[model samples]
Target chain A: MTPPPSATRPGAAALGLAGLLGLLLTVEVLPRSGVVSADYLPPTSRIVRALAVELNDRAFWRALGDTLTGWALGLAIAVVAGVVAGVLIGSVPFLRAATASTIEFLRPIPSVALIPLAVLLFGTGLGSTLLLVVYAAFWQVLVQVLYGIQDVDPVTRDTARSYNLGTWARVRHVLWPTALPYVMTGVRLAASVALILAITAELVIGSPGLGSRIAVAQTSQAVPEMYALIMIAGLLGLLINLAARTVERRALFWHQSVRGEAVL
Target chain B: MLDVRGLRKIYGGHGREVEALRDLTFTLDPGELVCLVGPSGCGKTTLLKCVAGLLAPTSGEVLLDGSPVTGPRPGMAVVFQEYSRSLFPWMRVRDNVELPLRQKKSLGRQRRHALVEDALEAVGLTASAGAYPWQLSGGMQQRVAIARALAYEPEVLLMDEPFAAVDAQTRAGLEDLVRKLWQERGMTILFVTHDIDEAVYLGQRVLTLSASPTVVQDELKITLPHERDQLESRADARFAELRTHVYAQIRAAGTRPAPTA
Candidate 1:
């Protein structure tokens, strides 16, 4: 059997640190050896030095805050609205049938395509960013919730009914339990979309965010700074995904994925 | 006590009326364990659903304690064959068992906990009360479903092919558990099954339904002793005789001509 998580996590962390150092060394060698252009991939050491300089700048911190706040607000709104709407639609076949064609029509339209319309309606600021983020996140989460609810077995519903479960009780006890894994899947998926849309809204429509900061660095010919900002955005996406996964694991420890893991 | 009179069910799709049950009539006394046996498509399931108030009869009435069953009453609980689908996958076993207790007006939290514990213990699931339904084997999950039903302390418990999905060994064990529970709780149980041997072994009386557009073809009273063991019950002369009698009735019902106006 494998070691306990307490021991495994520290070892995993060390491995990840080693991998980062190896990547830094390789990138450092590439530019000096003329193996790759420094302009495109600015050596990792230079990027880290630039990242240190940007960390002390008040404006960089402010922009990061603005982007993160917008992402958080947008994701929260999408989750509440999407899950509620999904449950309502999933539970009622008639409602799902009536609105399905409309959802399908709109889902394929990318959030990037909505930048101009959002800017027109909400102006070039947090409002536009929030709008795009919510739009990007909603459809994915909604579909997952619908599938989760739909996947709930008819026998469970019948069992709930036999127990004299009221409408609300059935949703709380039966429907929610059966649909949780699907909802978690949707949430994890939506987190990435939220990050992408937040960045895109900033980059395309001139909102104050890491994306806009990168644009500024690019215009100034600060290649290292630009690369560092891009790395920050990547890290942000990783953090969001990690956090969502952790929450999913804790909440659904009884779920199949967790149970399938060999116990210590 | 429950009564069924002139019960009819017709499947309306595919441009042809498929009558599942035709004027089925029967009466079940309180504290009786009755097994219903019939061929496939003989409306054994339809009758149980009607009696449980899950499905409305096309015509006629299912009376519960002299009143018509319009919807699920608090006095009834059901155990279905699909154990995996019958229990919520996310909830712990204890929560699943306690769910039905939530609907009972008289059960406070303390009382409910005691009842749930008792039911889980009775079903040999106390050690697994914290586990999820999916974590257990098929037989274990079925036991949890039974625990949920028994916890509710309903006056009438309906089981629809409750053990058909399990292996023969598990089926026999569950059959004995059902008999013990029925006697201990004094709850009226209407068990529907396609297995004649199972019907004979578990029930105090067996009700045989005719093929398609099912009606009660025969009702055989089990004169065997109450305390049952799987090995001895099958080998006993009385058990063999009762099984033979029920088998013959079901076979005859299977070949009988469809009723014509």
Candidate 2:
């Protein structure tokens, strides 16, 4: 049964505000109390002020835009590449078997470790950064999609076939919907990883993004600015995760877990 | 409208072979409703799958409308026992019912809507058209699955223990709903079940299968009247006789020794 509307909204609001306050306390009150060295992780007040100052700077916006572009471009590439490859690999048993060895060999090699090769190939630009993000995010999504397609209930597949639905139609209507929840989970995970790798690539390669800005602030000994950039990175990650979750909730409201009831 | 002749299936394994079905033969005319009763693992499902063209029999053939069934035919639809999995959980009930029409591609939007509405209303699920399958009770979900199958307007509907997962009361109610649909639409149906009473209650003819390498043991015509009620039919002398005959056949099947040369 659906939860009462009045109770549900206020409860959600309370939880959200509590979470916001908890983060505020961590960033502001604790540092203001002189619990740690403010030079390294300055008080939240200074960070907020720095954020306001940076918000007006054209270079700051450019760098933030660059980071988001890299993240979005890389995530889109990974989803397209991973889902296509996963479906092909999963549906074909012999191919899956042959590629199992190769995929296993390559899947474990850290994308961060490939930064040197990526740098040599593309140089320090958006291309190189996006490639690195795709590298980091693809394997996670590919594996989840592979398992998701394989885990489709046989009865459903049979039912679809029994209705004389063609292979593509069956995949679109039956396989896609059944595997979508899992794919969304994988994509959500990939978004977080993309954000991390976007910044990490920028940090490592001295690219024009938030990570590079943070590195520059650190080297310039602008401690408040560095803390401000770190806070911004954290907020970027938080926003990406929240966006993924909201999309998932809206798309999969029919899911049992989302509907919040036990099927008897 | 449908016929299965000498259907056979064998599952090959490591140094072993499982003969799931052997030399099974049955036929159904249009508007006929048949119930297949067998013990667990007796290959009733394999038989239905063969008829539905989901699995190719090792050595026999299924014919529909005088044509050999090679692959899944558009004239048939299946209602699996797991209704939750059968309907796409992400789609609304109306969308789920409308899916088959989308596959047909011959009907326009208005016609498709009418078909979906008719099927839903027939199954008493019009009120839940906007609800997801997972949000409904098990019986209601099963009804949705049936509605989906009915929406296809298939010549033959295959039900594999469609009501086994529901409560007893709901199962009885669903049986009645199915009977009403079958009488009204004249859709030929081949229903598989493990319950003997259910086989007799819902079928115009009850086909019993022998255990292990299942063969059609016997086919008995349900001579009971068409307009039957749950209470009166269960108590009627003819219903009792048919139920007793099916039960005895099943019991004999369990205890009967293997025939040898």
Prediction-by-prediction clash tally: 0, 0
TM-score each candidate.
0.90, 0.90
lDDT (tens digit, per residue) of candidate 2 on A102-170: 989998888889899879988999888988899889988898888888887888888777777777887
- The fnat scores of all predictions, in order, read 0.66, 0.80
* Lowest summed lDDT window (length 10), candidate 2 chain B: B252-261
Model 2 residue runs over 4 Å out of place are A1-49, A262-264
After superposition on all C-alphas, the RMSD of every candidate to the true structure, in Å, is 3.4, 3.4
Report the lDDT tens digits of candidate 2 across residue range B1-261. 898887889988899999888778889988999999998989888888888888888998899999999988888899999898888887888998998788887899999999999999999999999987887899999999999999899999999999989999999999999999999999999999999989999999999988867778878999988898999998999998998898888777767742321
Q: What tens-digit string does per-residue lDDT give for candidate 1 at A94-132? A: 999999999999999999998889989988889999999
Error of 1 at B202 (Å): 1.5
